[model samples]
Target chain A: SQTIHQWPATLVQPVGSPLSLECTVEGTSNPNLYWYRQAAGRGLQLLFYSVGIGQISSEVPQNLSASRPQDRQFILSSKKLLLSDSGFYLCAWSVRGPTEAFFGQGTRLTVV
Target chain B: GESVGLHLPTLSVQEGDNSIINCAYSNSASDYFIWYKQESGKGPQFIIDIRSNMDKRQGQRVTVLLNKTVKHLSLQIAATQPGDSAVYFCADSYSGSARQLTFGSGTQLTVLP
Candidate 1:
């Protein structure tokens, strides 16, 4: 079975501070990775997705960026944090083919 | 997708009654759809999925009905339970981009006990 692991379940960062959230997949290779941000009581907004290593597709222009360094390792980063950047960040992975995507526990970031 | 922050459409159903959630998409090329359930402070979980090839699919206690002509989908849950109260999301994907799912605005289901 495949499972996704995400770090820093919760974080409190100051304004203009850097942010780094990591997600790793186990028992799967070359999986499609995606990063999404969901505001309180709002639908999810796709931030970035990667089909392969070193390839990232950004959905919406924002203060955040994503990168896939390894086959099953994806990272979401930001040079400076904004008050609006705080939300529930989720990491998900699906197989190359048609299948259900599994999500991690997610990171609750609060920018004060 | 449009944002409905803090004011998502909600459904209130009595326990033991059936519940139906509806979703609509504008993409005609989408050939796959999926339904997910999200609880408070947690990520969305896969509930069920259906392919464009089929109009309907059944799960343990859930059924997804798809209408390609109208580009709409519906999820029916039998015997609504208190635990079934959550936010339901629908996602659509095309043929070539099977893994990149574009999500629909979610509906909050509130099971009345």
Candidate 2:
């Protein structure tokens, strides 16, 4: 069975501070990884997705960025955090083929 | 420009009654669709999925109906329970890119005893 792990289940960061959230998958290789930001009632917004290492496709322009350092390791980062950046960040992974993606526990970041 | 939208923002249902949540998509190329349920302060969980080729699919206590002609999708929960109370979202995808899904604004379902 495959499992996804996300760190810092909750974080409280100051405004303009740097942000880093990590997500990793086990029991699978070359999986498709995605980062999504979900706001109250706004739904899930796709921030970034990577089909392979060093290949990231940004869905929307924002203060956040994503990277795929290893086959199953994905990181979401920001040089500076904004008040609007605070939300539920989710990490998901799917097999290379047609399959539903599985999400992690998610990180609740609050920028004060 | 692909977009998915739900028909309602909130739905209140009585316990033991069936609940129906509806969604609509603007992308005609979308062939695959999925339904997810999310509780408060939690990530969305996969509930059920249906392909365009099929009109309906069933899970343990849930059913998903897809109407390609009208570009509408619906999730049906039978014998609704309090545990079933959550925000439900519908996602759509196409053939070439099956990994990424376009999600719709969720519908919050509240089960009342």
Candidate 3:
């Protein structure tokens, strides 16, 4: 069984402060990783995805960026946080092809 | 451009009754679809999925129906329970970019106990 771990489960950051959220997958190698954000009462918006180490694809242009430092470790970061950056950030993993994805618990980021 | 959308933003259903959530997509090239359930603060859980080749697929108590002609897909939950109260989102993907999913604006499903 594969599992994803994301932390901190909840975060409160001041405006303009730097931010970093980490996600890692276990029991699987070379899996596709993705970052998605969801506003309260809204659906998920794809932010970034990675196919392999050092390869990241941005779905939307915004204040966030993603980096795949390892085969199963992905990190979402921002040099400065904006009020609009506040949302529930989720990390997901999938196999190479079109298949069902698995998600982590998610990180609730609140930029005040 | 690819877009996935839901017919309704919210739905209320009685416990033990069947629940159906509908979704529509704009990309005719879409060959894969999926349904997800999300609790208040948790990540969306995979409920069911169907491919363009197959019109229907079933999971434990969930069913996903895909209609490529209409670019529509639906999720049916049997004997809905209180635990089923959550937001449901349908996603679409084409084979060219199956890893890249476009999600519909979720529908809030409230199960009345």
Candidate 4:
């Protein structure tokens, strides 16, 4: 009965503005967290993943960064947003081994 | 390098008919494969998964087939319904330590009512 909560469900940010997106998992501890972005027709791309607190791995180099502040809390942030940063951002959690990942509702970010 | 791809970009099927979605991968080390269904403006939902040890696995109304020799994967839905209409994506990953997944482009499945 684990659930992931992500907010805000939708966001609109001005170019060069700072951005922050939060995701937390309830009913699970020490779970593997991941950040993904889906662009138009580009498919889902893995941005970052964390194995534990204060440990983050970047899959692709970009303006966005991810942090695992707590065992269940993960945050994606950017100091300055770019027009290419606009996409549907998703947060997911999985067990230690290779297993199916559970995704949150996702945040639709639009940088204008 | 891990690369996953789909055979088609779109698929249209009649309601109550069977639907099949195909995917291909380049990494021979990939031992786990999964199929996901994504609605518009929503996260992808897990439909089914298959391990390399097994060639086939079945869920409620969904089935996943894995072919290691050809590095191909497929998802089959029985008696497709309007609710089954969505974008289907297949993902692959290694077994031991590498947990990161590589996802396919996805195939839009449109169910004609």
Q: By how many angstroms RMSD does model 1 differ from the true structure?
A: 2.3
Q: Determine which window of 10 residues in candidate 4 chain B has minimal summed lDDT.
A: B95-104
Off by over 4 Å in 1: B1-8
Candidate 2 residues A1-112, lDDT tens each?
A: 9999998899999999999999999999999999999998978988899999999999888999889999999999999999999999999999876568899989999999
Separately for all candidates shown, the number of backbone clashes (residues 3 or more apart, or on different chains) is: 0, 0, 0, 0
* Model 2 CA deviation exceeding 4 Å by range: none
Candidate 4 regions exceeding 4 Å error are: none
Chain A TM-scores for all candidates read 0.97, 0.97, 0.98, 0.98
Q: Rate the local accuracy (lDDT) of all candidates.
A: 0.88, 0.92, 0.92, 0.92
Best by DockQ: 3
lDDT of 4 by residue, A88-111 (tens): 999999988879999999999999
Fnat per candidate, as a fraction, reads 0.57, 0.66, 0.84, 0.66
* Candidate 4 residue A98 C-alpha distance from true site, Å: 1.8
Q: Worst 10-residue stretch by lDDT in candidate 3 chain A?
A: A38-47
Model 1 local distance difference test score: 0.88
lDDT of 1 at B28: 84
* Interface RMSD, in order shown: 1.4, 1.2, 1.2, 1.0
Candidate 1 per-residue lDDT over residues B1-113, each given as its tens digit: 33212223689999999999988887788888899999988889999999999999999999999999988889999999999999999888887664678776689999998
Question: lDDT tens string, model 3, A28-75?
Answer: 999999999988867789899999999998988899899998999999
